[model samples]
Target: MTRVVGKRAARRAELFDQLVGLFLDEGFAHLTLDDVAARLRCSKSTLYTLAESKDDLVRAATVHFFRRAADEVEEALARVDSGAGDRVTAYLEAVGDQLAPASARFMEDLARMPGARGVYEQNTAIAAERVRTLIAEGVGAGEFRSVSAEFVADVVASTMVRIQQRDVARATGFDDAQAYRELAALVTRGIAR
Candidate 1:
């Protein structure tokens, strides 16, 4: 993880990190310029230095957090010391763990904001590809039963998106973490011989 500052000076990296935590704790969409300024102990102008408006700030922060979360999930997968099937479980578990901290408000904000949803959809695509690869690998190694890797991967990925749906999550009465845990069990059982 190169500093998330992204070309800005080291100070902006610090500010971004601080802002990310705040946004994660309190929903980004609900935050005001004054709220950000007060939280960061900076003036509204300083807040403007980072974003053009509250919506822009929310969009930027949403992008930044999703990018960081994707990177962290990749890192977590890399650190898993297991076969592909277990790695898949670890990957899903890590994703759930990563999202474990997000408040329902934060989740709702991400669901409603188009910019944030785009970031999330991109991340979901990446995860789907990763699952496809992992399934193919497991099949090649004779660990998993021969199956349609792409189909299974697509199912897994689609379930991931379904679990994240606000209404679905509410209807099922499962938070994102539990949804993922259940997904892991459902997938691994169905796929395992």
Candidate 2:
């Protein structure tokens, strides 16, 4: 029974990942449950096993996406054998890379969906806090100049929100991924010792 349950859980996770990939490659707004089922080559019942409704499914998928991205970002940071400042740059660059696969349509769809947008906003806030922690560590280790980590994190958070809202893209003609890369460079250079 335990083996059966484990296999079931594994299949669910795999299906969920496939759903997320489809949503990432193509926005979810235009896709109905039937469309999703058709794309995934699974029945609507299988999707229902993941979430109760289409909106819930989208929200769950968004959460999953961020969770995976966070893991990858940390993994990238772990591979960096440099000082705190370099780790900070690596963290942000990994974030950019994680977001690189998100198409404009997916972003637009996220903006239109309050549930998914909220998830994105929450993750952005979390990322800002992570940045704050990294900055504080750098400052404590004397790898970065003395600066108010909280203030810098607030700025980064605000920019992240703007990036999510497409304001940065509109103003600079840079996509979210590009904006993140630019942000990484700017912040690293600004805080470096």
Report the number of the highest-TM-score candidate: 2
Backbone clash pairs for candidate 1 read: none
- Return the clash pairs for model 2, or none: none
lDDT (C-alpha, whole model) for all candidates: 0.80, 0.92
Scored by lDDT, the top model is: 2
The digit string of per-residue lDDT tens for model 1 on 50-115 reads: 888777777777777777888888898899888878987888887888888888888888888887
Clashes of each: 0, 0
Per-prediction TM-score: 0.89, 0.97
**Error of model 2, residue 128, in angstroms:** 0.5
lDDT of 1 at 97: 82
